[model samples]
Target: MSELIELFKDPYERRARLVPALLVALPLLVPLVCVYGPRNPILTAVLGLLGGCGALYALASVARGRGKKLEEALVKEWGGMPTTIALRHRDSTALDSVSKRRYHEAFSSKLGIGMPTAEEEAADPARADDVYIGATKRLRELTRGGRNLLLKENIAYGFHRNMLAMKPLGVVACVLGLAYGLIIAKALQLAPLTFAPGKIAAPGLAAALTLLISLAFFVAWVFYFDKDSVRRVGFVYAERLFECLPSLQPTMPRKRTTKSTASSDGPD
Candidate 1:
């Protein structure tokens, strides 16, 4: 959790988190103020909370994005490795080999892993492979625990994005449902639609209930149908990138050859 908070401390992350909250909150405030602000500050505030609910998901997305960047930054900071090798396998990049080489050199220098020699590369390819593979493996091990956390964050953010997109409809539905219920209650004088020690009439229960139901429906849709599809897209991208890591690739077993087959397999 502390790590998650630290991730959002970045300026880019803060922007990602804050923009969505403001987008959801501002429009929500207008209606709450116009309708209930004059009559009941308490109810208006409760509605205000619901209005900005989508912000939580946006912040979550920012955390995942930040975590991903931090994961790469750590690997580079440790050994000057390019974590993009894995990510680039699935994602597109326009960087040329020269730029990648220069970046790797500078990155390694900052981390105190001086440049390797052509003699070293040619003379001991296996040793160089070990070094690179170890670096990549360390990175994966460091990030493995956070994989589920990041996936949950991404999946949740997708759901929140859907909810925000449906906000106009949800808000309208809640308002209309409340209005209709109140009309019926008032006409039938259904228990005065109020309950308190004094004459303080609380009018937002119906709206709150309606909003709660809408939220539940949205959550269900995300969990049952939408989450799997969204998860698959994220999984595919991550899997492809992870596969690019040397240590993550699978090794195939060599087939045993019969004596006759072995004789035939020898060079002419």
Candidate 2:
């Protein structure tokens, strides 16, 4: 438990932003050059290079944003006492007794009050144990119920991570664009199709353009929708943790007893 607390105290490690950006841009540029040439293959290739750069820029932005958000959310949740306890025991009830006891001792000790005797401590690890189990139990239950909801958020975050990692949509767009350019160049070679007299490669060019546009839309969806899922999850978890804070603090009421006096009635 101490180790877990220590671990949560450390700053989070984030990946370099450059890596994902480079991956997205490199493949995307290949298709760009093939589609937009200056009638000179060399010049066309140069233009195509821009595609890679754009993809890289977009992917890098997504990765950096998601990574930062995830780190911040985790820190917020684990940095506090109540949230930390909830997360630490999100899985099992084994630590309930120990955690309750430790919290109780810490509270009493901090207030400069005498610690309960071993026998009294052993009698009930909860109420007398210094820590209130009712509140902890309530927190534990809230955390458990929220687990599935948080999991969905985690999964959404993961998908965004993969999108940043693989840059799949960007690669697909580049490939489709390249295919269309090649098809147009092939059709132009067979015979001059008089669509626009000079626009003989229109069909193939259109396909490639459509593919690039589709990829752009997909990327937007990933950024706006998928990324938001992770943020929402973090928000909910933080809120729940805050709700459990009162219970984490020990609230011991003073024990009160009444003294009785017997009255004598004139020898009855």
Using all chains and alpha carbons, the TM-scores for the candidates as numbered come to: 0.29, 0.27
Model 1 clash number: 1
| Model 1 CA deviation exceeding 4 Å by range | 1-14, 45-92, 114-268
The regions of model 2 sitting more than 4 angstroms off are: 1-31, 38-62, 73-87, 90-159, 162-203, 206-209, 212-268
Error of 2 at 251 (Å): 38
Best by lDDT: 2
Candidate 1 lDDT, 1-268, residue by residue in tens: 4544543564333443444334334334444554567889888777657535544545446444443444344434433223323212122242445544553343243322333344664575445434434433433443443455434443344333333433444455545444443442242234555523221143355434434444454444335433234334333433433333332333332111101211000010
What is the total number of backbone clashes in candidate 2?
5
Judge candidate 1 against the unseen true structure and give its global Cα lDDT, from 0 to 1: 0.39
Q: Which window of ten consecutive residues has the lowest lDDT sum in model 2?
A: 259-268
**Clash count list over all predictions:** 1, 5
lDDT of 2 by residue, 104-212 (tens): 4543433223334446545743333223223333334334434454434333443444344444445565455444444554533334542333443354554445445
